[model samples]
Target: MRPRFRRRNVASEGTESLGPSIPDGLWSKCPRCRELIYTREFERNHSVCPRCGYHARLTARQRIALIVDPESFVEWDAGLSPADPLQFVALGEPYPRKVAEAQERSGEREALVTGAATILGVPVGLAVAEFGFLGASMGSVFGEKFARAAERAAVEDRAFIVFASSGGARMHEGVFSLFQLPKTIVAVESLSERRLPFITVLVDPCYGGVTASFATVADLILAEPGAMIGFAGPRVIEQVTRQKLPAGFQSAEFLLQHGMIDAIVPRPRLREELAHYIRLLTNQHSASPVSFVTRQESDR
Candidate 1:
Protein backbone atom coordinates (compact mmCIF):
# COMPACT_ATOMS: atom_id res chain seq x y z
CA MET A 1 0.00 0.00 0.00
CA ARG A 2 1.15 3.49 -0.70
CA PRO A 3 2.34 5.48 2.30
CA ARG A 4 -0.34 7.69 3.83
CA PHE A 5 -0.19 11.07 2.05
CA ARG A 6 -0.01 14.24 4.07
CA ARG A 7 -1.88 17.33 2.91
CA ARG A 8 -0.10 20.58 3.70
CA ASN A 9 -1.77 23.99 3.83
CA VAL A 10 0.04 25.97 1.11
CA ALA A 11 -1.03 29.26 2.64
CA SER A 12 0.34 28.31 6.04
CA GLU A 13 3.55 27.15 4.44
CA GLY A 14 3.81 30.50 2.60
CA THR A 15 4.00 28.60 -0.64
CA GLU A 16 0.95 30.48 -1.83
CA SER A 17 -1.25 33.24 -0.52
CA LEU A 18 -4.97 32.68 -0.14
CA GLY A 19 -7.35 35.33 -1.42
CA PRO A 20 -10.33 35.81 -3.67
CA SER A 21 -8.85 36.37 -7.07
CA ILE A 22 -10.76 38.48 -9.56
CA PRO A 23 -12.65 36.26 -11.97
CA ASP A 24 -11.96 36.37 -15.68
CA GLY A 25 -15.21 38.26 -16.30
CA LEU A 26 -14.89 40.82 -13.52
CA TRP A 27 -12.31 43.29 -14.69
CA SER A 28 -14.07 46.30 -16.17
CA LYS A 29 -17.53 47.66 -16.87
CA CYS A 30 -17.92 48.99 -20.38
CA PRO A 31 -19.48 52.44 -20.32
CA ARG A 32 -21.10 51.96 -23.70
CA CYS A 33 -22.29 48.37 -23.53
CA ARG A 34 -22.73 48.09 -19.77
CA GLU A 35 -20.91 44.77 -19.85
CA LEU A 36 -18.05 43.52 -17.74
CA ILE A 37 -15.00 41.98 -19.41
CA TYR A 38 -11.83 40.26 -18.40
CA THR A 39 -8.91 42.64 -18.17
CA ARG A 40 -6.73 40.23 -20.07
CA GLU A 41 -9.25 40.04 -22.88
CA PHE A 42 -9.49 43.81 -22.97
CA GLU A 43 -5.74 44.14 -23.20
CA ARG A 44 -5.61 41.48 -25.90
CA ASN A 45 -7.85 43.66 -28.00
CA HIS A 46 -5.49 46.62 -27.49
CA SER A 47 -7.82 47.93 -24.78
CA VAL A 48 -10.86 47.97 -26.98
CA CYS A 49 -13.75 46.33 -25.20
CA PRO A 50 -14.82 43.28 -27.21
CA ARG A 51 -18.44 44.07 -26.58
CA CYS A 52 -18.62 47.88 -26.88
CA GLY A 53 -15.50 49.01 -28.77
CA TYR A 54 -14.64 51.28 -25.88
CA HIS A 55 -11.01 52.35 -25.90
CA ALA A 56 -8.91 51.89 -22.79
CA ARG A 57 -6.05 54.03 -21.59
CA LEU A 58 -2.51 53.09 -22.69
CA THR A 59 0.88 53.89 -21.20
CA ALA A 60 3.56 55.77 -23.09
CA ARG A 61 5.91 52.80 -23.35
CA GLN A 62 3.16 50.61 -24.68
CA ARG A 63 2.19 53.24 -27.22
CA ILE A 64 5.76 53.62 -28.44
CA ALA A 65 6.27 49.89 -28.78
CA LEU A 66 3.04 49.54 -30.67
CA ILE A 67 3.73 52.34 -33.11
CA VAL A 68 7.48 52.37 -33.72
CA ASP A 69 9.56 49.75 -35.47
CA PRO A 70 10.70 47.11 -33.04
CA GLU A 71 13.91 47.97 -31.15
CA SER A 72 14.38 51.20 -33.12
CA PHE A 73 13.64 53.78 -30.45
CA VAL A 74 16.41 55.71 -28.70
CA GLU A 75 15.07 58.04 -26.02
CA TRP A 76 16.06 61.73 -25.83
CA ASP A 77 16.28 64.07 -22.84
CA ALA A 78 16.22 61.14 -20.47
CA GLY A 79 18.19 63.17 -17.92
CA LEU A 80 16.13 66.34 -17.83
CA SER A 81 14.41 66.78 -14.46
CA PRO A 82 11.32 68.61 -13.29
CA ALA A 83 11.73 71.40 -10.75
CA ASP A 84 9.26 72.16 -7.99
CA PRO A 85 9.16 75.83 -8.83
CA LEU A 86 6.06 76.40 -6.73
CA GLN A 87 7.15 74.01 -3.96
CA PHE A 88 3.57 72.91 -3.82
CA VAL A 89 2.54 70.39 -1.19
CA ALA A 90 -0.42 68.10 -1.41
CA LEU A 91 -1.51 65.29 0.87
CA GLY A 92 1.71 65.74 2.79
CA GLU A 93 3.74 65.06 -0.36
CA PRO A 94 5.97 67.56 -2.10
CA TYR A 95 5.46 68.06 -5.83
CA PRO A 96 9.04 67.01 -6.52
CA ARG A 97 8.51 63.81 -4.58
CA LYS A 98 5.40 63.15 -6.62
CA VAL A 99 7.42 63.57 -9.80
CA ALA A 100 10.09 61.21 -8.53
CA GLU A 101 7.49 58.61 -7.68
CA ALA A 102 6.02 58.96 -11.11
CA GLN A 103 9.43 58.50 -12.68
CA GLU A 104 9.97 55.35 -10.67
CA ARG A 105 6.65 53.94 -11.78
CA SER A 106 6.95 54.92 -15.45
CA GLY A 107 10.73 54.52 -15.91
CA GLU A 108 10.71 57.95 -17.54
CA ARG A 109 12.21 61.19 -16.28
CA GLU A 110 9.44 63.33 -17.68
CA ALA A 111 5.83 62.90 -18.74
CA LEU A 112 6.93 63.00 -22.39
CA VAL A 113 9.71 60.93 -23.94
CA THR A 114 11.09 62.36 -27.16
CA GLY A 115 13.42 60.37 -29.31
CA ALA A 116 14.81 59.63 -32.77
CA ALA A 117 13.83 56.34 -34.32
CA THR A 118 13.10 54.50 -37.56
CA ILE A 119 9.55 53.47 -38.26
CA LEU A 120 9.38 51.07 -41.20
CA GLY A 121 12.92 52.21 -42.04
CA VAL A 122 11.90 55.88 -42.29
CA PRO A 123 13.79 58.05 -39.85
CA VAL A 124 11.58 60.22 -37.65
CA GLY A 125 11.49 62.02 -34.35
CA LEU A 126 8.85 60.78 -31.90
CA ALA A 127 7.35 62.00 -28.65
CA VAL A 128 5.06 59.93 -26.47
CA ALA A 129 3.24 61.20 -23.39
CA GLU A 130 3.40 59.16 -20.21
CA PHE A 131 -0.09 59.49 -18.85
CA GLY A 132 1.05 57.75 -15.69
CA PHE A 133 2.96 60.94 -14.87
CA LEU A 134 0.53 63.35 -13.32
CA GLY A 135 -1.97 62.57 -16.05
CA ALA A 136 0.72 63.35 -18.67
CA SER A 137 0.33 67.05 -17.98
CA MET A 138 2.63 69.49 -19.73
CA GLY A 139 5.29 70.94 -17.44
CA SER A 140 8.41 72.94 -18.30
CA VAL A 141 10.35 69.77 -18.99
CA PHE A 142 7.63 68.45 -21.25
CA GLY A 143 7.73 71.66 -23.25
CA GLU A 144 11.50 71.63 -23.45
CA LYS A 145 11.56 68.01 -24.56
CA PHE A 146 8.99 68.65 -27.30
CA ALA A 147 10.80 71.72 -28.54
CA ARG A 148 14.05 69.81 -28.62
CA ALA A 149 12.47 66.93 -30.54
CA ALA A 150 10.99 69.27 -33.12
CA GLU A 151 14.26 71.13 -33.48
CA ARG A 152 16.12 67.85 -33.81
CA ALA A 153 13.78 66.66 -36.54
CA ALA A 154 14.23 69.89 -38.48
CA VAL A 155 17.97 69.81 -38.10
CA GLU A 156 18.20 66.18 -39.15
CA ASP A 157 15.80 66.62 -42.06
CA ARG A 158 13.47 64.03 -40.60
CA ALA A 159 9.76 63.86 -39.90
CA PHE A 160 8.24 64.41 -36.44
CA ILE A 161 5.60 62.27 -34.75
CA VAL A 162 3.85 63.00 -31.46
CA PHE A 163 1.45 60.93 -29.41
CA ALA A 164 -0.60 63.31 -27.28
CA SER A 165 -2.44 61.97 -24.25
CA SER A 166 -2.87 64.38 -21.39
CA GLY A 167 -5.23 65.91 -18.86
CA GLY A 168 -3.85 69.42 -19.37
CA ALA A 169 -1.05 71.66 -18.19
CA ARG A 170 0.44 70.53 -14.90
CA MET A 171 -1.47 72.25 -12.15
CA HIS A 172 1.33 71.80 -9.67
CA GLU A 173 3.75 73.62 -11.95
CA GLY A 174 1.23 76.50 -12.40
CA VAL A 175 1.80 79.12 -15.08
CA PHE A 176 5.23 77.82 -15.92
CA SER A 177 3.55 74.71 -17.32
CA LEU A 178 0.99 76.77 -19.21
CA PHE A 179 3.78 78.57 -20.99
CA GLN A 180 4.71 75.26 -22.62
CA LEU A 181 1.68 75.60 -24.86
CA PRO A 182 3.18 78.50 -26.79
CA LYS A 183 6.68 77.10 -26.58
CA THR A 184 5.70 73.80 -28.17
CA ILE A 185 3.61 75.62 -30.74
CA VAL A 186 6.59 77.68 -31.74
CA ALA A 187 8.73 74.58 -32.04
CA VAL A 188 6.16 72.96 -34.33
CA GLU A 189 6.05 76.21 -36.32
CA SER A 190 9.77 75.87 -36.82
CA LEU A 191 9.18 72.38 -38.22
CA SER A 192 6.68 73.90 -40.63
CA GLU A 193 9.26 76.42 -41.74
CA ARG A 194 11.58 73.53 -42.55
CA ARG A 195 8.75 71.85 -44.49
CA LEU A 196 9.12 68.70 -42.48
CA PRO A 197 6.08 66.49 -42.05
CA PHE A 198 4.64 66.48 -38.54
CA ILE A 199 2.22 63.74 -37.56
CA THR A 200 0.17 63.72 -34.36
CA VAL A 201 -1.30 60.51 -33.02
CA LEU A 202 -4.03 61.31 -30.52
CA VAL A 203 -4.58 58.68 -27.86
CA ASP A 204 -7.43 58.26 -25.45
CA PRO A 205 -8.14 61.12 -23.05
CA CYS A 206 -6.04 63.73 -24.92
CA TYR A 207 -7.33 67.09 -23.81
CA GLY A 208 -6.72 70.64 -22.51
CA GLY A 209 -3.62 72.68 -23.31
CA VAL A 210 -2.07 69.83 -25.26
CA THR A 211 -5.07 69.59 -27.54
CA ALA A 212 -5.02 73.33 -28.06
CA SER A 213 -1.34 73.45 -29.02
CA PHE A 214 1.11 70.96 -30.57
CA ALA A 215 -1.54 68.28 -30.90
CA THR A 216 -3.50 70.56 -33.20
CA VAL A 217 -0.54 71.72 -35.28
CA ALA A 218 0.45 68.45 -36.87
CA ASP A 219 0.31 68.24 -40.64
CA LEU A 220 -1.44 64.89 -40.32
CA ILE A 221 -3.52 64.07 -37.26
CA LEU A 222 -4.33 60.44 -36.51
CA ALA A 223 -6.52 59.40 -33.61
CA GLU A 224 -6.86 55.99 -32.10
CA PRO A 225 -10.27 54.45 -32.42
CA GLY A 226 -12.68 55.57 -29.70
CA ALA A 227 -10.12 57.97 -28.20
CA MET A 228 -11.31 61.11 -26.46
CA ILE A 229 -9.87 64.25 -28.14
CA GLY A 230 -11.14 67.50 -26.76
CA PHE A 231 -10.14 70.72 -25.02
CA ALA A 232 -12.31 70.15 -21.92
CA GLY A 233 -13.65 66.94 -20.43
CA PRO A 234 -17.28 65.95 -20.73
CA ARG A 235 -18.13 66.40 -17.08
CA VAL A 236 -16.62 69.88 -16.99
CA ILE A 237 -18.41 70.87 -20.17
CA GLU A 238 -21.69 69.50 -18.93
CA GLN A 239 -21.36 71.26 -15.61
CA VAL A 240 -20.52 74.54 -17.29
CA THR A 241 -23.23 74.25 -19.92
CA ARG A 242 -25.79 72.94 -17.39
CA GLN A 243 -26.84 70.20 -19.80
CA LYS A 244 -26.30 66.52 -20.30
CA LEU A 245 -23.65 65.83 -22.92
CA PRO A 246 -24.49 63.54 -25.78
CA ALA A 247 -23.14 60.05 -25.82
CA GLY A 248 -19.75 59.74 -27.56
CA PHE A 249 -19.20 63.45 -27.34
CA GLN A 250 -15.49 64.27 -27.66
CA SER A 251 -14.71 60.74 -28.83
CA ALA A 252 -12.30 60.08 -31.72
CA GLU A 253 -15.16 59.01 -33.96
CA PHE A 254 -17.07 62.12 -33.05
CA LEU A 255 -14.07 64.31 -33.78
CA LEU A 256 -13.49 62.52 -37.09
CA GLN A 257 -17.05 63.20 -38.11
CA HIS A 258 -16.54 66.83 -37.17
CA GLY A 259 -13.27 67.09 -39.17
CA MET A 260 -11.10 67.41 -36.06
CA ILE A 261 -9.14 64.24 -36.85
CA ASP A 262 -7.73 63.27 -40.19
CA ALA A 263 -8.32 59.60 -39.53
CA ILE A 264 -9.55 57.18 -36.89
CA VAL A 265 -6.98 54.44 -37.05
CA PRO A 266 -7.37 51.09 -35.36
CA ARG A 267 -4.47 50.02 -33.19
CA PRO A 268 -3.30 47.16 -35.39
CA ARG A 269 -3.29 49.28 -38.55
CA LEU A 270 -1.77 52.40 -37.02
CA ARG A 271 1.86 51.46 -37.57
CA GLU A 272 1.44 50.51 -41.20
CA GLU A 273 -0.74 53.50 -41.95
CA LEU A 274 1.66 55.87 -40.27
CA ALA A 275 4.59 54.43 -42.17
CA HIS A 276 2.70 54.78 -45.42
CA TYR A 277 1.82 58.38 -44.65
CA ILE A 278 5.39 59.22 -43.75
CA ARG A 279 6.66 57.65 -46.93
CA LEU A 280 4.21 59.65 -49.00
CA LEU A 281 4.81 62.94 -47.20
CA THR A 282 8.56 62.60 -47.31
CA ASN A 283 8.49 61.75 -51.02
CA GLN A 284 10.28 58.49 -50.38
CA HIS A 285 9.31 57.29 -53.84
CA SER A 286 10.96 60.26 -55.49
CA ALA A 287 14.38 58.73 -54.96
CA SER A 288 13.43 55.90 -57.35
CA PRO A 289 13.50 56.19 -61.16
CA VAL A 290 10.13 54.40 -61.31
CA SER A 291 8.59 57.13 -59.22
CA PHE A 292 9.92 59.78 -61.58
CA VAL A 293 8.25 58.03 -64.47
CA THR A 294 4.99 57.79 -62.49
CA ARG A 295 5.16 61.45 -61.61
CA GLN A 296 5.78 62.39 -65.22
CA GLU A 297 2.83 60.28 -66.35
CA SER A 298 0.61 61.85 -63.70
CA ASP A 299 1.64 65.30 -64.79
CA ARG A 300 0.69 64.37 -68.34
Candidate 2:
Protein backbone atom coordinates (compact mmCIF):
# COMPACT_ATOMS: atom_id res chain seq x y z
CA MET A 1 0.00 0.00 0.00
CA ARG A 2 1.19 3.52 -0.73
CA PRO A 3 2.38 5.54 2.25
CA ARG A 4 -0.53 7.42 3.86
CA PHE A 5 -0.23 11.04 2.91
CA ARG A 6 -0.13 13.18 6.03
CA ARG A 7 -2.08 16.41 6.16
CA ARG A 8 0.41 19.23 6.54
CA ASN A 9 -0.60 22.27 8.61
CA VAL A 10 -0.24 25.24 6.26
CA ALA A 11 -1.72 27.56 8.90
CA SER A 12 1.73 28.31 10.35
CA GLU A 13 3.46 28.92 7.01
CA GLY A 14 2.63 32.66 7.00
CA THR A 15 2.25 33.06 10.76
CA GLU A 16 5.63 34.64 11.37
CA SER A 17 5.01 37.49 8.94
CA LEU A 18 1.24 37.76 9.21
CA GLY A 19 1.11 37.79 13.02
CA PRO A 20 -1.06 35.85 15.47
CA SER A 21 -4.03 33.75 14.56
CA ILE A 22 -7.48 35.26 14.60
CA PRO A 23 -9.78 33.06 16.66
CA ASP A 24 -11.28 30.70 14.13
CA GLY A 25 -15.09 30.50 13.94
CA LEU A 26 -15.32 33.19 16.61
CA TRP A 27 -18.41 35.42 16.55
CA SER A 28 -18.03 39.16 16.34
CA LYS A 29 -18.22 40.73 19.78
CA CYS A 30 -21.28 42.88 20.27
CA PRO A 31 -20.21 46.50 20.70
CA ARG A 32 -23.12 47.22 23.02
CA CYS A 33 -23.62 44.06 25.05
CA ARG A 34 -20.24 42.33 24.61
CA GLU A 35 -21.91 39.05 23.82
CA LEU A 36 -20.23 36.36 21.73
CA ILE A 37 -22.21 34.23 19.29
CA TYR A 38 -21.64 32.33 16.10
CA THR A 39 -20.79 34.37 13.00
CA ARG A 40 -23.01 32.20 10.87
CA GLU A 41 -25.91 32.93 13.18
CA PHE A 42 -25.23 36.67 13.01
CA GLU A 43 -25.19 36.58 9.19
CA ARG A 44 -28.46 34.70 9.16
CA ASN A 45 -30.03 37.61 11.06
CA HIS A 46 -28.82 40.10 8.45
CA SER A 47 -25.69 40.93 10.49
CA VAL A 48 -27.64 42.09 13.50
CA CYS A 49 -26.78 40.62 16.87
CA PRO A 50 -29.61 38.52 18.19
CA ARG A 51 -28.70 39.26 21.80
CA CYS A 52 -28.19 43.05 21.78
CA GLY A 53 -29.12 44.02 18.20
CA TYR A 54 -25.71 45.41 17.31
CA HIS A 55 -25.27 46.05 13.62
CA ALA A 56 -22.26 44.57 11.88
CA ARG A 57 -20.40 46.10 9.01
CA LEU A 58 -21.45 44.96 5.55
CA THR A 59 -19.47 44.75 2.33
CA ALA A 60 -20.32 46.75 -0.82
CA ARG A 61 -21.02 43.58 -2.76
CA GLN A 62 -23.41 42.42 -0.07
CA ARG A 63 -25.32 45.70 -0.15
CA ILE A 64 -25.43 45.69 -3.95
CA ALA A 65 -26.76 42.18 -4.04
CA LEU A 66 -29.31 43.02 -1.39
CA ILE A 67 -30.64 46.18 -3.02
CA VAL A 68 -30.21 45.79 -6.76
CA ASP A 69 -31.95 43.54 -9.24
CA PRO A 70 -30.05 40.40 -10.11
CA GLU A 71 -27.90 40.62 -13.29
CA SER A 72 -28.91 44.30 -13.66
CA PHE A 73 -26.09 46.31 -12.09
CA VAL A 74 -23.59 48.11 -14.37
CA GLU A 75 -20.82 49.73 -12.35
CA TRP A 76 -19.44 53.20 -13.09
CA ASP A 77 -16.04 54.80 -12.44
CA ALA A 78 -14.46 51.36 -12.04
CA GLY A 79 -11.16 52.83 -13.29
CA LEU A 80 -10.92 55.81 -10.94
CA SER A 81 -8.05 55.55 -8.45
CA PRO A 82 -6.67 57.41 -5.47
CA ALA A 83 -3.73 59.80 -5.88
CA ASP A 84 -1.02 60.41 -3.25
CA PRO A 85 -1.15 64.20 -3.15
CA LEU A 86 0.49 64.44 0.27
CA GLN A 87 3.06 61.71 -0.27
CA PHE A 88 2.51 60.71 3.30
CA VAL A 89 3.98 57.65 4.99
CA ALA A 90 3.14 55.83 8.19
CA LEU A 91 3.92 52.55 9.93
CA GLY A 92 6.67 51.68 7.42
CA GLU A 93 4.21 51.97 4.54
CA PRO A 94 3.37 54.77 2.11
CA TYR A 95 -0.14 56.21 1.87
CA PRO A 96 -0.63 54.79 -1.62
CA ARG A 97 0.42 51.34 -0.40
CA LYS A 98 -2.10 51.54 2.45
CA VAL A 99 -4.78 52.59 -0.02
CA ALA A 100 -3.91 49.64 -2.21
CA GLU A 101 -4.16 47.33 0.77
CA ALA A 102 -7.58 48.75 1.69
CA GLN A 103 -8.77 48.32 -1.88
CA GLU A 104 -7.56 44.74 -1.93
CA ARG A 105 -9.38 43.97 1.29
CA SER A 106 -12.61 45.64 0.12
CA GLY A 107 -12.41 44.37 -3.49
CA GLU A 108 -13.09 47.93 -4.58
CA ARG A 109 -10.75 50.68 -5.76
CA GLU A 110 -12.44 53.27 -3.56
CA ALA A 111 -14.72 53.50 -0.59
CA LEU A 112 -17.80 53.94 -2.78
CA VAL A 113 -19.02 52.09 -5.87
CA THR A 114 -21.30 53.95 -8.29
CA GLY A 115 -23.47 52.09 -10.73
CA ALA A 116 -26.76 51.90 -12.62
CA ALA A 117 -29.32 49.19 -11.95
CA THR A 118 -33.01 48.46 -11.61
CA ILE A 119 -34.87 47.63 -8.44
CA LEU A 120 -37.90 45.60 -9.56
CA GLY A 121 -37.42 46.98 -13.08
CA VAL A 122 -37.43 50.67 -12.14
CA PRO A 123 -34.17 52.14 -13.44
CA VAL A 124 -32.12 54.03 -10.87
CA GLY A 125 -28.58 55.16 -10.16
CA LEU A 126 -26.94 53.49 -7.16
CA ALA A 127 -23.95 54.27 -5.00
CA VAL A 128 -23.01 51.89 -2.21
CA ALA A 129 -20.22 52.40 0.31
CA GLU A 130 -17.66 49.73 1.02
CA PHE A 131 -17.03 50.08 4.73
CA GLY A 132 -14.02 47.76 4.56
CA PHE A 133 -12.08 50.65 3.00
CA LEU A 134 -10.81 52.55 6.02
CA GLY A 135 -14.38 52.75 7.34
CA ALA A 136 -15.63 54.06 4.00
CA SER A 137 -14.24 57.52 4.59
CA MET A 138 -14.95 60.20 2.04
CA GLY A 139 -11.95 61.09 -0.10
CA SER A 140 -11.25 62.68 -3.49
CA VAL A 141 -12.11 59.55 -5.41
CA PHE A 142 -15.27 59.03 -3.38
CA GLY A 143 -16.42 62.56 -4.08
CA GLU A 144 -15.63 62.24 -7.78
CA LYS A 145 -17.59 59.05 -8.02
CA PHE A 146 -20.62 60.57 -6.30
CA ALA A 147 -20.60 63.64 -8.50
CA ARG A 148 -20.19 61.57 -11.63
CA ALA A 149 -22.97 59.27 -10.62
CA ALA A 150 -25.34 62.18 -9.99
CA GLU A 151 -24.46 63.70 -13.34
CA ARG A 152 -25.09 60.39 -15.04
CA ALA A 153 -28.46 60.09 -13.35
CA ALA A 154 -29.42 63.58 -14.39
CA VAL A 155 -28.41 62.88 -17.97
CA GLU A 156 -30.38 59.66 -17.99
CA ASP A 157 -33.33 61.08 -16.00
CA ARG A 158 -33.11 58.23 -13.51
CA ALA A 159 -33.63 58.30 -9.78
CA PHE A 160 -30.47 58.65 -7.67
CA ILE A 161 -30.00 56.34 -4.71
CA VAL A 162 -27.11 56.23 -2.27
CA PHE A 163 -26.32 53.91 0.59
CA ALA A 164 -24.20 56.05 2.89
CA SER A 165 -21.90 54.25 5.35
CA SER A 166 -18.78 56.08 6.48
CA GLY A 167 -16.75 57.26 9.44
CA GLY A 168 -16.51 60.64 7.71
CA ALA A 169 -13.77 62.45 5.76
CA ARG A 170 -10.51 60.56 5.23
CA MET A 171 -7.88 62.12 7.45
CA HIS A 172 -5.02 61.02 5.24
CA GLU A 173 -6.40 63.08 2.37
CA GLY A 174 -6.64 66.17 4.64
CA VAL A 175 -8.67 69.24 3.66
CA PHE A 176 -8.97 67.99 0.11
CA SER A 177 -11.17 65.24 1.39
CA LEU A 178 -13.36 67.58 3.42
CA PHE A 179 -14.01 69.65 0.30
CA GLN A 180 -15.87 66.72 -1.18
CA LEU A 181 -18.62 66.98 1.42
CA PRO A 182 -19.99 70.19 -0.09
CA LYS A 183 -19.13 69.09 -3.62
CA THR A 184 -21.28 66.03 -3.35
CA ILE A 185 -23.99 68.03 -1.66
CA VAL A 186 -24.06 70.46 -4.56
CA ALA A 187 -24.40 67.62 -7.07
CA VAL A 188 -27.34 66.22 -5.16
CA GLU A 189 -28.88 69.68 -5.06
CA SER A 190 -28.57 69.86 -8.82
CA LEU A 191 -30.46 66.63 -9.07
CA SER A 192 -33.13 68.08 -6.78
CA GLU A 193 -33.47 71.12 -9.04
CA ARG A 194 -34.20 68.78 -11.93
CA ARG A 195 -37.09 67.36 -9.88
CA LEU A 196 -35.44 63.95 -9.79
CA PRO A 197 -36.00 61.81 -6.73
CA PHE A 198 -32.92 61.16 -4.62
CA ILE A 199 -33.06 58.47 -1.97
CA THR A 200 -30.54 57.68 0.76
CA VAL A 201 -30.27 54.44 2.68
CA LEU A 202 -28.27 54.87 5.85
CA VAL A 203 -26.29 51.87 7.03
CA ASP A 204 -24.72 51.20 10.40
CA PRO A 205 -22.16 53.66 11.78
CA CYS A 206 -22.88 56.51 9.37
CA TYR A 207 -21.41 59.62 10.88
CA GLY A 208 -19.04 62.62 10.51
CA GLY A 209 -19.04 64.56 7.23
CA VAL A 210 -21.21 62.04 5.43
CA THR A 211 -24.21 62.47 7.74
CA ALA A 212 -23.97 66.27 7.51
CA SER A 213 -23.86 66.42 3.72
CA PHE A 214 -25.36 64.35 0.93
CA ALA A 215 -26.98 61.83 3.26
CA THR A 216 -29.12 64.41 5.01
CA VAL A 217 -30.23 66.04 1.75
CA ALA A 218 -31.99 63.08 0.18
CA ASP A 219 -35.61 63.48 -0.84
CA LEU A 220 -36.39 60.22 0.88
CA ILE A 221 -34.23 58.63 3.56
CA LEU A 222 -34.45 55.01 4.60
CA ALA A 223 -32.16 53.45 7.16
CA GLU A 224 -31.20 49.85 7.72
CA PRO A 225 -32.34 48.28 10.96
CA GLY A 226 -30.02 49.03 13.90
CA ALA A 227 -27.84 51.48 11.92
CA MET A 228 -26.34 54.52 13.61
CA ILE A 229 -26.92 57.82 11.82
CA GLY A 230 -25.55 61.05 13.21
CA PHE A 231 -23.00 63.78 12.74
CA ALA A 232 -20.70 62.83 15.64
CA GLY A 233 -20.19 59.38 17.06
CA PRO A 234 -21.41 58.58 20.54
CA ARG A 235 -17.89 58.51 21.98
CA VAL A 236 -17.11 61.95 20.60
CA ILE A 237 -20.41 63.36 21.75
CA GLU A 238 -19.92 61.97 25.22
CA GLN A 239 -16.47 63.48 25.49
CA VAL A 240 -17.45 66.84 24.04
CA THR A 241 -20.66 67.35 25.98
CA ARG A 242 -19.70 65.37 29.09
CA GLN A 243 -23.20 63.88 29.01
CA LYS A 244 -24.01 60.21 28.86
CA LEU A 245 -25.94 59.20 25.79
CA PRO A 246 -29.15 57.27 26.18
CA ALA A 247 -29.25 53.68 25.11
CA GLY A 248 -29.72 53.30 21.34
CA PHE A 249 -29.42 57.08 20.99
CA GLN A 250 -28.37 57.03 17.37
CA SER A 251 -29.83 53.73 16.23
CA ALA A 252 -31.87 53.48 13.04
CA GLU A 253 -34.95 52.37 14.90
CA PHE A 254 -34.64 55.30 17.30
CA LEU A 255 -34.29 57.72 14.43
CA LEU A 256 -37.29 56.23 12.68
CA GLN A 257 -39.49 56.63 15.75
CA HIS A 258 -38.31 60.23 16.14
CA GLY A 259 -39.27 61.01 12.51
CA MET A 260 -35.71 61.47 11.34
CA ILE A 261 -35.91 58.62 8.85
CA ASP A 262 -38.73 57.95 6.44
CA ALA A 263 -38.64 54.28 7.32
CA ILE A 264 -36.57 51.57 8.95
CA VAL A 265 -36.09 49.06 6.18
CA PRO A 266 -34.96 45.51 6.70
CA ARG A 267 -32.48 44.00 4.23
CA PRO A 268 -34.91 41.71 2.43
CA ARG A 269 -37.61 44.32 1.87
CA LEU A 270 -35.29 47.13 0.69
CA ARG A 271 -35.51 46.22 -2.98
CA GLU A 272 -39.29 45.98 -2.97
CA GLU A 273 -39.72 49.25 -1.14
CA LEU A 274 -37.30 51.05 -3.43
CA ALA A 275 -39.06 49.69 -6.49
CA HIS A 276 -42.41 50.88 -5.23
CA TYR A 277 -41.06 54.39 -4.69
CA ILE A 278 -39.37 54.47 -8.09
CA ARG A 279 -42.51 53.38 -9.90
CA LEU A 280 -44.60 55.93 -8.08
CA LEU A 281 -42.19 58.74 -8.91
CA THR A 282 -41.82 57.65 -12.54
CA ASN A 283 -45.58 57.48 -13.10
CA GLN A 284 -46.19 60.82 -11.41
CA HIS A 285 -43.79 62.53 -13.83
CA SER A 286 -44.38 60.60 -17.03
CA ALA A 287 -45.71 62.79 -19.88
CA SER A 288 -48.91 61.92 -21.63
CA PRO A 289 -48.71 60.61 -25.20
CA VAL A 290 -48.62 63.16 -28.06
CA SER A 291 -51.79 61.72 -29.60
CA PHE A 292 -53.66 62.01 -26.31
CA VAL A 293 -52.49 65.58 -25.78
CA THR A 294 -53.43 66.54 -29.36
CA ARG A 295 -56.89 64.99 -28.96
CA GLN A 296 -57.43 66.92 -25.76
CA GLU A 297 -56.34 70.13 -27.48
CA SER A 298 -58.76 69.48 -30.39
CA ASP A 299 -61.63 68.89 -27.97
CA ARG A 300 -60.79 72.14 -26.19
The candidate that wins on TM-score is: 1
Summarize candidate 1's per-residue lDDT along 1-300 as a digit string, tens digits: 011112233334442344344333335556667665665667677667787666666777888887788899998888898999999998999998898899898788889988988888888899999888888999999999999999998998889999999988899999999899999999987789988899999987798999999999889999988777899888788789998888788888899899888998888777788889988887775353666778899999
**RMSD each, Å:** 9.2, 10.5
lDDT of 2: 0.82
Q: What is the lDDT of residue 269 in candidate 1?
A: 78
At residue 213, give the lDDT of candidate 1.
94
> Candidate 1, which segments miss by more than 4 Å at Cα?
1-52, 286-300
Question: lDDT at 82 for candidate 1?
Answer: 96
Q: What is the C-alpha lDDT of each candidate?
A: 0.83, 0.82
Per-residue CA lDDT of model 2 for 1-300, tens digit only, reads 011112222334444543456444434556657665566677677666688655566688877886787999999989998998777787878889999899888788999999999887778999999888988999999999999999899888889999999988988888989899889988886687788889999987799999988998898999988787899888889899999899879988889888988988777677888887776775653445568778999999
Please give the lDDT score at residue 239 for candidate 2. 95
Q: Score residue 249 of candidate 2 by CA lDDT.
A: 91
